[model samples]
Target: MARLLSELISFLEALPEPRIVMDADYRIVAANAAYMREFGAAGGLVGRRCYEVSHHFSVPCDQAGESCPLKQSLESGTPQRVLHLHHTPRGEEHVAVDTTPIRNEAGEITYFVETMSVVRHSSSRPAAQGLVGRAPAFIRMLEKVMRVAHSGAAVLLLGETGTGKELVAHAIHEASSREKGPFVPVDCAGMTETLFESELFGYEKGAFTGAAHRKLGLVEAAAGGTLFLDEIGELPLSQQVKLLRLLETGTYRRVGGLDCLSADFRLVCATHQDLRAMVAEGRFRRDLYFRINSFPIHTPALHERKEDIPLLASSLLERVDRRPGRRLSPAALNWLQGRRFDGNIRELRNLIERASLLADGDTVDLVHVQEMAEDLPLDLSASAGDAAGEFRVSGVQPLAELELAYLRWARRQQPDDTGELARALGVSPRTLYRKLRAAGA
Candidate 1:
């Protein structure tokens, strides 16, 4: 048994990615050199609980409201994969965790081997670029992005207007095998069929009245890279068949040229409209839709992941507000979070930029945000009421039902700590626990 364990440890050390071996009880029995170099800041990892080292939790990840890959692997007796936020030397980072159970000769599960892959394309904290957010919904979307990034499958980003679908598409490009290549974004909105053909398939000299010289099309320009088609739903029916033909045959020709040129580029499409309904209405081609929708991923709207407002607001402030040491006050953040952002991240950035411009001091106060946000839409159902602590409710609903809903929302806002949530709500931990249990949270 000792020799086998030694050989296993040696094998793990040979792997490049960070890996660890654990017993059935979730204790880290051994860690490879990669794991130690990456996650060994909290002293030695052997004999310590994996949850404690990764998440600082007393219990397993699932018990603390996280999807534990080890637990899932144990139950299914197979490999399990999950995206997690782990405490790293650089701070909390998004890590893709994969676990596989090891069975003995008698078919008894003896140990589990887990590998960690840090996601460099996204951040759990404020970042200068790329994706940011630690909300559950955001994590789910990011997980899908990671899963499909390495493949050559066409990706369809579905989301509402101003939800940052283009950014998400860029992230997919950056994380894919074609990261070294260019990311060409084509705005399909308001593009005419003639323009689409010439712009996408190039145009040789004298192809039309305005064509004086050979012009490279987006398809050729995006060779060995990703071609992101933004608002593909808005692409006119006449242009849909043109794109479908290009995708189906993987070949194209210049407007005035007869030679067919082979196209070599990955396709990533985004849309705010419902393509399925459009297909049924005959407004969109079923064949084109099927081709582009090979792997569909939804980019969550700001409202869908309200818990990420604070992180996103901070990140956006850093991006839009160039003034040194400029920041949003706590009250301003709370006020920003309570409002309904119908326009999603774009609206939020607009509000932040406007408030930053209005504020004289380094801190953008609640007054500044309120003054700048006067023209925005309001949610009558739940309002911030001039303060973060004040919750003004509208519409007729049972008090009990309202309480349950508010509690659920609040829990989402502070998922890690019941104690902190209770303190914020001006209630005892025990009382909050009882309420959560009764509410089936």
Candidate 2:
């Protein structure tokens, strides 16, 4: 028996899934290599209770009621299965947990075995395709994605257009155990109302016009992986009902096929529009909105988090211009900082790409930036409300007073760094500091 158990442990260790063994008392007895690699530094897990290591809970695993598979198997002498959300020792994020039981002599369960699958964002292995920026907002969103990636719950990614909601969804898939599976993306806006059902659930050969062949839907193609529905707000009301039904039962029938097929895939939806408002306007189903919003993440807009502009600009420039020593000049960066980017990160990236092409040398100067800016429609509406009322550069508002107001606004937008402001107003750092002091900022 001892020899057999030793061999089992070795095999479990070699398995790609994270595996851990817990004794009858729910105390962790052994953990495999994959488990340690997934959780990071599982040394302290030994002798600790399963709940302690898996959930950071101080109590017994059964404290959450009799639904615990480990306790159920120990009591009933029957194999059990359960899903759990577990945090790793290094506090990386939550993982999808699966638990089973190992029996000994007399058919009594002696140890509980747990398996974990780490979720990932996308199947793309390119290191350069990682989430951009180290800003607090960006990091916080990444952490949220990691936490919810493993669950069966639907995720709603809310952000302005071009905030990379789709990228975040891919990151969630990549971080999950489903990394080996396919990641399929569906653009809801592109699907006509009449074709929505067939496109999403797929159709059988001769199901409808142009249904030339049997096909696997995006959901089926993403089995054991992730299905990303972009612009979900654009989904027609009729399709919304079908989607909601599938989400509820995990069952669907291919067009022209009577047999129902079930698919197991994680769902991640993204949209630039306000889903809540759409629901109120009768354009979207309220129930569907609630269903997908189970785990919601709001991506920060570029203008709302201007402090990250420099990093974003630099990253965009590197992506567009791979030339050696390519860099943005201080003057050009200042102009970018002062101007409100109405189109958000996408617009900024486009501008940088154009500026890089127009730049004569490796250094992108203000002239190149200005040339690009000239082509862009003036964003007067962006600053109208804040700079228009009682804060204008005319009348009783002296140059110093105007500077103070602008400084205050600038500080609010880009705190912790005045470099952008200095460049925007075309002043030396020392001069900007003296002016700020004079204005009592």
Candidate 3:
């Protein structure tokens, strides 16, 4: 048994990724050079608990509300994979963990071999580019992205309008085997049949009127890489058949050319619309839906992961605010966290951009953000005198709930303009929007 364990450790040492062998009790027995260099302890790692070394946790990861791959592998008797935020030497980082159970000759599970890899395309902390999230929903979605990144499977991203599907698609492309190849994005929204053909399949000179030169289509440009089709639900049904034929045959022809050009690119489609329902309603082709739905990943909406609001807002402020040393005040962050964003990340980014523009000093305060929210278009037709009545509520309720209810009632009286309603209610427009969203109005 000792010799077998030694051999297993030696074999893991040759691998590039960080690998560790631990007992069933989660004590680190052996670690490869990669593991030592990446997650080295002040004292040697051996004899230390894996959870303590990696997560600084007194208990197992599962006890800490994280999925424990070791516990999972023990139950399934197979490999288990999970994404975890690990405490690294630099800082907290998003790490993908794969654990396999090692059984002895008696068929009893003896040890576990765990491999760790850091996610480069994303960050647990705020990042300047790529994905920035630490919420459970974000991790769940990222786990799916990592699983399908190395494969040739067609990817379908489904989410709300501003859920950052295109960014997810780009992350997939960057992580995939075709990282060196071009990543071409084609917006399917409002794309005409003629444009779809010429744009996706390229066009020969004189293929149509005003054809001055031959053009390379998006599919051909993305050779050996990924082609992202954004908002594919908006694509006209008339053009869907042509796209289906091209995908099925793996070939296409120029507008005026006769020779069929072979397409050599991975397909990734995204939509805020439900393609299954579209198929049921005869609005989308079932065959094409199946083709692109090989590996579907859900991009979580901002509201679903509200815990990441501060991180997202900080990162977005960095991206949008050109003024160096500018930052959001704590009050501003608090206000942002309490507000609602129906347009998700995009809406949050716009708010930050507008606030940045309005802010003159280094720090953008709550008033700056509130002013931006107040600038929202309102009906402004109803007068404030319409809301001059006593507000009443029955039954026991939380103070916050009561406040939100009162805001809703006040909103109904002055339904025309939220800015005017805020003045009448003696609250800021930012407060009005937050309470309104909480009230589900």
Q: Please tell me which predicted candidate would have the highest TM-score against the true structure.
A: 3
lDDT ranking from best to worst? Answer: 1, 3, 2
The regions of model 3 sitting more than 4 angstroms off are 375-441
Candidate-wise lDDT, in order: 0.88, 0.73, 0.87
Better lDDT candidate (1, 2): 1
**Each prediction's TM-score versus the true structure:** 0.86, 0.60, 0.87
- Candidate 1 root-mean-square deviation in Å: 10.8
| Clash number for each model | 0, 18, 0
Q: Distance (Å) between predicted and true CA of 312, model 3?
A: 0.2
lDDT of 3 by residue, 309-332 (tens): 889988898888889668899988
| Candidate 2: tens digits of C-alpha lDDT, residues 1-441 | 576568778878778888888777888777898878768554567888887766667776568542477767777766665444456554444344556777776776667787776434321111234556545466556557766866767899999998878778888787777888988999999677657777778889998888889987777888889999999998889889999999989899988999989989988999999999999999999999998889999888776666667767777787787574588888777667656576888889899899899987879988988788743322222243343334333233235435556665555454556787688768888887886665445
- Where does candidate 3 have its weakest 10-residue lDDT segment? 375-384
TM-score of predicted model 3? Answer: 0.87
